[model samples]
Target: MRPVDEHVAHAVSLMAPVDLDEVALAEAFGRVLARTVTARYDSPRFDNSAMDGYAVRAAEVTVGTRMRVAADIPAGSGEPPALHSGTCARIMTGAPVPHGADAVIPVEHTDAATAEVTFYQSAVTGAHIRRAGEDARAGDAVVAAGQLLGAWQLSAAASAGHATVAVRRRPVVAVLATGDELVDPGMEPGPGQIVDSNSTLLSMLVTAVGGVPVVLPRCPDRPGAVAAALAGVDADLIVTAGGASVGAYDPVKADLAGHGVEFFAVAMQPGKPQGLGTVNGIPIACLPGNPVSVAVTFHVVVGPMLRALLGAVEPKVLAAPAAEGWKCPAGRAQFVPAVVESDGSVRPATGGGSRSHLVASLAAGRVLAVVPAEVEQVYAGDTVGIMTSILENMG
Candidate 1:
């Protein structure tokens, strides 16, 4: 059996990075940036007022001083005339301060007037003024490469004068769930048959990792059904659930064995049966049949592959103390569907342990508590490594 880390590294090596495309900022949300974005101009662009007030010379303004409002400067107006010795400019928030003016007294600090304004408070130098390049200067790196373009990042890119950003194209993933005993969801199952929820699960997982999932039709456990279902399909990666084990009716192994897919028994509990290879230039990953196994394998293997295609960094694993004890598989690493409590401790999401077939209990899991193969059991207060979904914690 192959080690889990070796299998994951091998699986990720099979995928190539997706091509980059220049997309409009409106459509760049959730996309990974392909290049570093630089500022075309300074942030705030010029010296502007941070508040709606009068732009004045600091040394000229005093308490109870009455100055004539020589000009009204609203936001978006062009350069205004310079401030005279005994006069000030009525400047609104975000409006550029007039030339020769070094301070701004907020409107609330003075009597609200249009033609003639009286200052009840003295003005301080450099007060309430947003200086040019204060946040960022021209040509400065605003957003670095490989950063996911969220609302905040996109806004910064826009403020850097970018109408469109170069981003990695989302990888197209074809999800195939193969099993003779499977039926479409929402249909009543007959004897010896079950609902096919793996397709939905895998598709959602692919999408959550920033990949576009193309859910293929269910392939049966027939001689050439797996090959026939994936023939001429257009996708960067192919993910197949079920039929990866050593069962007699495992069609994914039976059909794609000689055609580029190499099956393996990974050293991990709840997700040991795995396959990693490519089919006709497209990468393919065949996972175990159980729902929990699919969840675990996708997170450890397939999800990382998708992220790699998008030029994204891998998910982070945080170490936390175990809230309770749990037995682990003898020689296989354990990936228990677990939850992080409010106290920052980790525990199994269900009492049933890491049983692969425990589908219903998988929903309660928010993270995977990873244990090494040598660790026979996790005692309470023992430090354990927990892995979270990349998209779940992305902001």
Candidate 2:
């Protein structure tokens, strides 16, 4: 059996970043930047007021010193006339400061009149003025290539005058859930059949990890249907859930074994049976069937592959203290669904161990507590590595 690290390495090795495309800021979320983003102009664009106040000469405004309001400048208005000696301009938040104004005294500190104003105290030089390029100067790098785009990144990019960005195209991943014992969710299954949850879990996981998930219909245990499904799907990556085991009805293994697929054993709890293959140069990753196993393996294995395929920077692994004790499996590494406490300690979502199937009971977890192969048990306050159950939560 291959080690979990080896499997993870192999999964990453099979994938490559998709082609880059220029996407509008409206559609940049969850995408990786293909090129470094530089500021086109200064962040503030020009010296502006940070608050609704009077823009005045610093030395002119003192306790009981009054000045005539030379002009009113609100945000987005054209440039106002220069400030004359002993005079100030009435300014609103984000309004450009008039030339010769060295400070902005907020309206709250004034007499609250529009035509004339008196400061409670002396105006500090450069106070409440947002200087141009204070946040970023022209040509300053705002974001690096391979960085993932989120709300903050998009906002910064827009502020940098980028209407569109060159980002790695979202990898299209086709999901084929293989089994005869599984039926569509919301449909009553016949005897000996259960509802299919892998499709739902995988598709959402794929989207969470920044991929375009295309979930196909469930494939039956028959060889012909499995082959046809494998041959017909078009995507950047192909993922088959189930049928990697040595069961009698495991058609994914029985039919695709020698047909460009390499079914193998991975030394990990709940996700031991795995397969790696390619079709027309597109990478394929086969995961185990049980809902919990499917989720765990995706977090531990497939999620990284998808991120690599999307050209995302490497994921950051975090370590936390184990909140409680549990029996760790022998010979195979174990990954249990867990909730990381606010203090950075983690505990299992359920008392029941990492059984290959128990997704229903483990739904509230946000992380997967990992135990190494040689460890036989865990004690309270032990340090353990963890994989975020929500793939996007990593880094």
* Most accurate candidate by TM-score: 2
* Tens-digit lDDT string for candidate 2 (1-395): 88999999988999877899999999888788999999999998999999998999998888888888879999999787899998898999999999999999999888877888888878999999999999999999998888888888889999999999999888889998988899888999899999998999999888888788998878999977777886767798988899999998898888778777898889899899999878656788889999889988888888889878777777666789999999987888999888878888998888887888777545778878889999999999999888766654524
Q: Give candidate 2 misplaced runs (Cα > 4 Å).
A: 223-225, 342-344, 391-395
Candidate 2, residue 255: how far the Cα is off, in Å:
1.9
lDDT of 1: 0.91
Each prediction's number of clashing residue pairs: 0, 0
Q: List the global CA lDDT of all models.
A: 0.91, 0.87
State model 2's lDDT. 0.87
Best candidate according to lDDT = 1
- TM-score of structure candidate 1: 0.88
Q: lDDT tens digits, residues 70-137, model 1?
A: 99999999888898888999999999999999999999999989898999999999999999999999
Question: Which residue ranges in model 1 land beyond 4 Å of their true spot?
Answer: 60-66, 115-122, 319-325, 343-346, 379-383, 390-395
Q: How far is 230's C-alpha from truth in model 1 (Å)?
A: 2.8
- TM-score (C-alpha, index-matched) for candidate 2: 0.91
Span of ten consecutive residues with least summed lDDT in model 1: 386-395
